[model samples]
Target: MNVDPAVPLACEPANQNAGTALQDPEQGALSADEYALFASVARVRRVYAGETLFHRGDLGTTMYVIAKGAIELDFGEDLIAKSLGPCEFFGELGLLIGDHARSADARAIDDGELLELRHEEFQRLVEIDPTLVSYFLRRAIMRVVFNEQSLIRRLRRRNQDLQSALDSLRATTQQLSRTEALVRRDELTGLYNRRGLLQHLRERHRNGATSGLGLLLIDCDQFKRINDEHGHLIGDRVLQGVANILRSVAGTNDIACRLGGDEFCLLVKAETREEVMRYAEFVIHTSHGLLQMPQLPPLICPMSIGACLVCAEGEWNDWYARADTALYRAKRQGGNRVEWQDNAPIPA
Candidate 1:
């Protein structure tokens, strides 16, 4: 095609006209000199608004130059789509690239004329102008540099986003752990409360590892009398004092709970009869401070304990009832003592 250098390089309403600035190297419209040199190989085509010119994954045999209106090239993989206006040429990479596959989808945003250049045509044009090889080489190097920089930016952003998500997840997990601990503990005595007691007992029983596990149910004998005589404040201090004593005497593997009111429970790991008796005696001996009435005058802190061995064959409630029965016997036979479900009694 003989393009007259004097004629303006512009597209007509229906199609592109030959002889334009696209072939003029002096014009800055083409980013590279190679585009102006090889663009002469292209033929004109007409496109309308909302018309699809090309798609990603299609065999890219030809490149397009927009002489009029606008065209959008959407990289199918990313939201970073680009819009090209007049005097801009696209798919010019056909001259330097060999894979010949479209990298993005190209659609017309408005009615316009385009110049389509095929790879074969570009090769023939290169033979006509031997310097075309040098221009194409320069453009290829520039494309490589631009693409590498773009990929690096995307990777850095992705890494930052991943780190942010992990940090949020870690914070959420820690908060849940704190909330769970608070829910299972008593606010007043800092011991496991009733809800904590039930959950622990149920889990222990379900595990079928109740061998050597023993239960000690404790109650503050004549507690109501102390609260009535010394006010609830003194009564609460007495309860906390008893809890401290039990906590101190209990083994590291054992669990202690306050079952509301003046009732408490201790689950111990004493394997033999002697071990169990030792725990019971130690609790009674150390709790003498509670029995002393600082303000109420000798009528305070007296407690009764019911002991029973935990059995895997029995349910949590059954073990509790047996221990409770032992407690009932200790209370019935006068308080301030321990009664074993096996009929053994601990000296107060």
Candidate 2:
């Protein structure tokens, strides 16, 4: 391990004998002939702790064998990468493969000694001592293989964990979707509830793009009288019947909501005012015609429809109030008739 003090420490390779005589083994432990051969081919250098020996993109003209202390190897931008202890070597693969630069950064971890061998000199030694070359090459190859296997195992475990987390997220999303649907829908009539209707109206108002905002507020004529005469069960059936008619007549873009008791609201996106009037008339006519009650004598279900066209300038609440006023007017005039807020019907 004895090294010559006369050898200048420089980053570049120096021309010297492939082997030379040395007194001590601190530079590297080698027999007389081995020392001569290596001395002719390589030079020894002392490195300080926390010093960068080589960077990731440095020229691959030389390789190092750690005589003492430890070195750290870094890949990419990682701060704490991998470490190599004393007697370990690195950068030989880059030299052997004719790589232009080092693949990873190497730094000394502690005050250390290293044997730096020039690429040409090392290749010459490998050619001369084939057996020694084969021994070191086999060990290096095994080390690389073991490292790759360890990396593969870690990646597989990470992938499994990620997949499990994704599955859990998917299950939670499905459960939330079901809960939201239940909240929006009325249980008794199977229509959208008042809360859902308000939410829809607010969203439409926010958009402010008037395709056609129409609201119809419908109430069962004399609903209290029917409930008093037949009981609550018959009243429930009447509500279900009205809901069915609304569902059948309303378009996909339209929403039918039961605003509790016998009051219902229909929000429609009609192309024209005429289309809105036609839809209102259809709902009023159909709801009055379809009355199925076997328990009561002469089952007749009538509804008062109050329809209004919502202006783009008005709020959702303002539009709802207008529709409510029209509904009251229809109820005052007659039971089974439709009334519009803007257009009053002529006396026949």
Candidate 3:
């Protein structure tokens, strides 16, 4: 088949002739006359079923107008595909813009006859009928604009979804941190528990800063007798009062911890054994004075304290054993007193 160079390429009403029409969902269909006009000026090519007409990104210099059978246009990457039947046209961009790259892969699903208008023929048609060619260009450009807008909207929605996921992750992280803090705290005293004390020591040891520190182990003398006479509610209040006293005497670098029932310890920064002794004395004196206050509950028990300097050459177990021995000595000497363990090598 051959097309006359003088024939105009313009759309007509779909009902004008009994010939096949070019279908476009957005702009409606073109009349059989218009389809014939394009075919008349173009070269005819036969394509077999399952034949590829063109591929995406292939530089194209010709446009195809279908006369028989079905063709499919596949634009990958989440874009919707298009199916075209008889009288539909595709690849217009190739003829309009010289050497234009195809945007989609076009394949024939059935044996078909297509009207292929090369760049030379398109140029001659434009010269013969500029007004009709301009109208055709406007319609094709509109379709391209619509597709671009649809892609932009999809990208925007995806970005918002990603942001929401990130926010949810951050909230979950913060909640986990708060839960960890509660796990390491004493309920009655709002102070570090035994677990927290170990964690603090581990951190300091990791930084190699555990040397020149003091550990003061304290025990409430006759605590069981006091609890037996007073209710457990009063016992809890007494513990809270002892915690407050420890808090008041502790320095900025000190850590006050409750190591379970009737036992507490203070980890303080002390350069000499004398400093450790002074801390133990201060705790014993303040605790005795506080128990005798008129508004507070009357109690006969006193705090027995043992002081030991944390040796650079020793482990935490060694330091704890020596301090515990000193604590027993203070209790044996009848409580309300401070005892110190001289820095010495472990017996084992």
Maximum-lDDT candidate: 3
TM-scores, all candidates, are: 0.51, 0.51, 0.54
Q: After superposition, how far is residue 214 of candidate 2 from its true place, in Å?
A: 1.5
The residue pairs found clashing in candidate 3 are 3-40, 3-41
How accurate locally, in lDDT, is each candidate?
0.67, 0.66, 0.73
Q: Flag regions of model 1 displaced more than 4 Å.
A: 1-156, 289-300, 343-348
Q: 183-218 in candidate 3: lDDT tens per residue?
A: 578989988998788878877888898888999999
lDDT of 1 at 149: 47
lDDT of 1 by residue, 158-263 (tens): 4553344335445544554565566678877778887777777767767866778788899998888888878888888878877887788777778888888999
